[model samples]
Target chain A: MPEGSMGISNIATCTAPVNIAVIKYWGKRNEELILPINSSLSVTLHQDQLKTTTTIATSRSFQEDRIWLNGKEEDINHPRLQSCLREIRRLARKRRSDGDPGLDSTGLSHKVHICSVNNFPTAAGLASSAAGFACLVHTLARVFGIEAELSAIARQGSGSACRSMYGGFVQWIMGHQDDGKDSLAQQVEPETHWPELRILVLVASAERKPIGSTSGMHTSVETSCLLKHRAEAVVPVRMDGMIEAVQRKDFPAFAELTMKDSNQFHATCLDTYPPIFYLNNVSHQIINLVHQYNNYYGETRVAYTFDAGPNAVIFTLQEHVSEFIQVVRHFFPPETNDGHDFMFPCVVLKAGPGPCVVDDPTQHLLGTDGWPKKTE
Target chain B: MPEGSMGISNIATCTAPVNIAVIKYWGKRNEELILPINSSLSVTLHQDQLKTTTTIATSRSFQEDRIWLNGKEEDINHPRLQSCLREIRRLARKRRSDGDPGLDSTGLSHKVHICSVNNFPTAAGLASSAAGFACLVHTLARVFGIEAELSAIARQGSGSACRSMYGGFVQWIMGHQDDGKDSLAQQVEPETHWPELRILVLVASAERKPIGSTSGMHTSVETSCLLKHRAEAVVPVRMDGMIEAVQRKDFPAFAELTMKDSNQFHATCLDTYPPIFYLNNVSHQIINLVHQYNNYYGETRVAYTFDAGPNAVIFTLQEHVSEFIQVVRHFFPPETNDGHDFMFPCVVLKAGPGPCVVDDPTQHLLGTDGWPKKTE
Candidate 1:
């Protein structure tokens, strides 16, 4: 009856795509459950361009759970992390108790070792939390042999993470129930919905330490009357329009709504008490350049959305990508081809699939020994 | 009578202090009439530190209406300029028609010549329009022998100019009148009411060409839902609290409201279509600095407000002025005392009287011949 008599060990590696929200998710009604105040829709960028690969291994012989984020050890007792693990374990136990034919009943009680790493450089300042958490939840679910809808479990890690659990266009429904069961992400459209849609991530030149999203949203919910109004009166209508625009493949309609929603999100940030400024001078200039560029063409060829940071996530059709990239360079010229300011890391991305199991053993971030593999 | 044959001319030079809004006035119900969407309150800074000295002359033999601003000739037919002039003339004609014995009916047909100049350097980038328009209306009224309230007339030139027409704490009431007669500035407290209150104008060294207030407000009104909510739901209660704060001389209450209203105004700007950015990076830093300083003291010792530009106008009590100045210098060190970024032009000011007619001939910006006096 020894724990390791059968040497029970299972490892799953999953890669998740980053989602850029057109209808932004800002505040949360239930902080612990990570339920949003309003439903939000986002475009899942292709994983070939930007993604987070998470490798999770569970072993009965392991003493305790441990987690490494980008090769750095983090507190395993973090509330959100604990919540995600607890929910997945509960799901696995339920599946086994229901007499499911395929279930790793022994691994359900096993300690897990998790390691997540992003494909893109951290200097880009693109928020990886969405993809990281989504990957974590997906990989954890796989290792635990639980196949049920896991967006709700990912929701416990981060509100936006729920949306990242789906591919292409996704919306996180702000569920009404107190238990947050119905508050799961739904796929508005599949990966093949819009092949021409492209996203440009304009990395900020200056490194600005902006306020973290969790505290920012907390303050916005508490002090900002505008945030309350937006959540109650504005977002519901915006969500419908966004869904329609995505379904119709209307770039201009989609672009305009995306930019407005992003601006409104920052507006609420500024409206918070003592006010939070996520957009720096560079972000402001980029915004003007986008409008000016659009005005010049008499069309919104490109749209930008910021996520609690200065880095701009631009949405444009594949046809306009080259021209808009030229314009961005012209306005914000990189000092040189290799300058930091113009890192010009334009990962031209299109709508892509969500978390997928990676069969390649070499792609795992965690070693067979259940620890982060050191990279030289 | 031959032109200049009888030099029957009356010249009055009046200086109007600059007023910084604690409760901002953004967006107008009527563009032509300068009717505001919401009420706003301001603190009129001392004329000695910052003012617009405007000299107006009404002469029977002058050639035509002319204006020279800051020694540079400007078009006399600007619509807002014409509005102020026409209103002043109508008031004078009514006074003369009523058969007032002291009324100079002779000057009724006279052409006016105006020469306006700001005491603060143009490099300061403070909006001279408010003080300039207030002074123009007041001085024109004095020269034309009409003593009725002039904030309504000043408002035509610039929306914020109306608040500058009064000393101490002034509020521009957003009256529900088609004619905008009731939307005039009212004095909540005299200059002597809050003597301990002080203002520090932290003029920006670098000039930023922001969207002009008229166009910015126009866009906010047309596009931003947040602006509408702010005008209707937020400002009325804020206006009352601001007035009470002023009347009771509650520095902390007044300071908190000032910062919040300023932030809300900027929030509306960001919520505008394409969004407008008034507070630059420097302004944002100043805001953080103020909040941090206040936090350090365990009391709200100082508060900062930014209008439609980068310059920060900080409100604090006289007792904390020296310490705050030191803190500002420590945080934003001036580069060798003459660097452009650290102009550090902190003009300490207090509430002062409204425009007053300067009887001294030496102070006149206009010559006896109704022409601009050269400033050699």
Candidate 2:
């Protein structure tokens, strides 16, 4: 996607955790700069269960910059990909010009080879782009020795990608500027702040969404009056309450706000002129089950938030996780009791670290020859 | 329920057509008085295909006030029912006190018996309450020999019932009055104004809705900010556009406004706390089919609106009805081709008269004995 490091002898591999927005980021104000209409908060899930590993290798012998996604080589010139590459290299040059001593010695502008793959299914409507871009930017920074304020660059790749640059509870502030320079993600709390907080990603359907968020949001901004009102009046207050709930570890408050924000997001979708329906029958069934389960407990024990798809990302406390999983199983029975289709078919995760370099050479996605390696 | 016409010897029978709101009524400013928070407009469907017939009889030997709905006796003292009964009697008494010569001949005060039934299924969620209450109030008015303004009395029965009291396109103005005397339904245009407009009631599900409109609107008024905004800002402008569209006989303009208003109503439902979902998978599929069919024609040939349940009410020009019905059948095949459950299980309706006296003695719901008779 971009010219590789000046002269790096070693490949850089980094893993980025997927972040699920509780306060969803839907419409964008500035399409080109990827600025959101409202501030959103999200939790970065543990990389151990779900993550994207991206390895970038630079070589003087390489003919051109190339990229491989999920073991398949794809166009390196996709507009958003190009934006990420341009921003990262511009920052590297700035660092070198400022005599930061981060540039390598060879002074050779080499072609780049990037290989990225996710441990989970990309078709599950998860925020894979967020993790992909976050990992790419994080790896590029490591290669170029450029460290400060990288989230702004990641925002160019994908709007929500900026949030995955930080772990645990992060807020992407909707700044009031034409250039969107101030709309960057800030960490509200680290992964360890709420150990009791747990996440379950229930995959309702593995099919890709019919309409992408980019196009769906474009129509919403143009047609949906509710979305405009929400951006102007509703979200400002919700963002503050969400941050406070995270800071205080108030489970009930956080759960209620999260669920309400999610419903409001989908409501705006329905309010669109022709209307957009992202949640299907299974999604509705899961929503009903969650509400019934909470009502049975006489409290808000668990909350579910969906992001532009049928899959549900659940938020619950550690104490309720086991029982809740059992309850979910009781309602939505798996097709098979065998190990393959069993276990409720969801990943139990927690808040975890953001993108970081992998120190082990054996885990590198590229060979020492600066080429893509074939995995078993 | 009201002591029937100062004891008229003859039973009065009246039929009222169902009204489907293009501009929905979802909240209340005064619950007891049934004053809506926003003005709404609806089309009264033709009575031949779908209507409610009510008969009222007064006799000196009759017992306390009683009522029968769909061949089953129901509580006569239901608060809303009582409100209608009390309001009508108060108006009749005032008329008598003013020396009105048009009052009935019989001066003997007697108890009343009322019987009501629908030509269509009551559980279809087809605004049966609107038709039922309109028929009730209209029958009572004929029995009492009072006819100055009866829509306000019908409003006390059910909010939408006010619209059904007038023929063709009616607009119920959300008047600002503590007593709700000014909140009344007025005819925007008679049924003969437009002969090309057609409607189809697509029966998605006949099952009773889990939450009734009365209670659902209560929750929405209390919890949904979008509902308040729609009432205060959105619906007023929408009401004007809808009335103009109906007057101009602009099918596209009318269809678009109808679809948009219905979407906004359902959007507010989803924005409620814990949220309310009225459209099921079939409803969504029908919506998609309409959009796709319209897109295929490169024009708005058809439009759909859903109320508090899954059934879809379609609006199209007379020229497009047959083609659109064919498209709907192609998408959603009927389970049977027999006379029963066949024909797509829908009634093709057109704008028609409001409530009127059914003069034929043999057509009366109540027998000559002044009690409910067994029907074949």
True contacts kept of each: 0.68, 0.62
DockQ of 1: 0.53
Q: Residue A224 CA error for candidate 1 (Å)?
A: 1.2
**Interface RMSD list for the candidates:** 3.7, 5.9
Question: Which docking category, incorrect, acceptable, medium or high, applies to candidate 2?
Answer: medium
| Candidate 2 positional error at B242, Å | 0.8
Say which candidate scores most in TM-score.
2
Q: lDDT tens digits, residues A1-376, model 2? A: 2344433354789999899998989899899999989999999999998999999877776788899999899999999889988887787777777876646734236667898999988857799999999998998777656778989889999999999999999999888889888999999999999999999988877778877899999999999888988888888899999999999999989999998898899999999978998887667767888889899989999998999888888999999999999988887788644222233547889999889889998888988777778762
Instruction: Write the residue-wise lDDT of candidate 1 on A1-376 in tens digits.
Output: 2245434388889999888889999898889888889999988888997899999988776789998877788999999999999999888888888999866587777899898888776534565788988999999988888889999999999888898999999999998999999999999999898998888888875364467788889999999999999999999999999999999999999999999999999999999998999887778878998999999999888899988878888989989889889888877677744223454636788899999999998987877677788871
Q: What does the lDDT read for residue B6 in candidate 1? A: 48
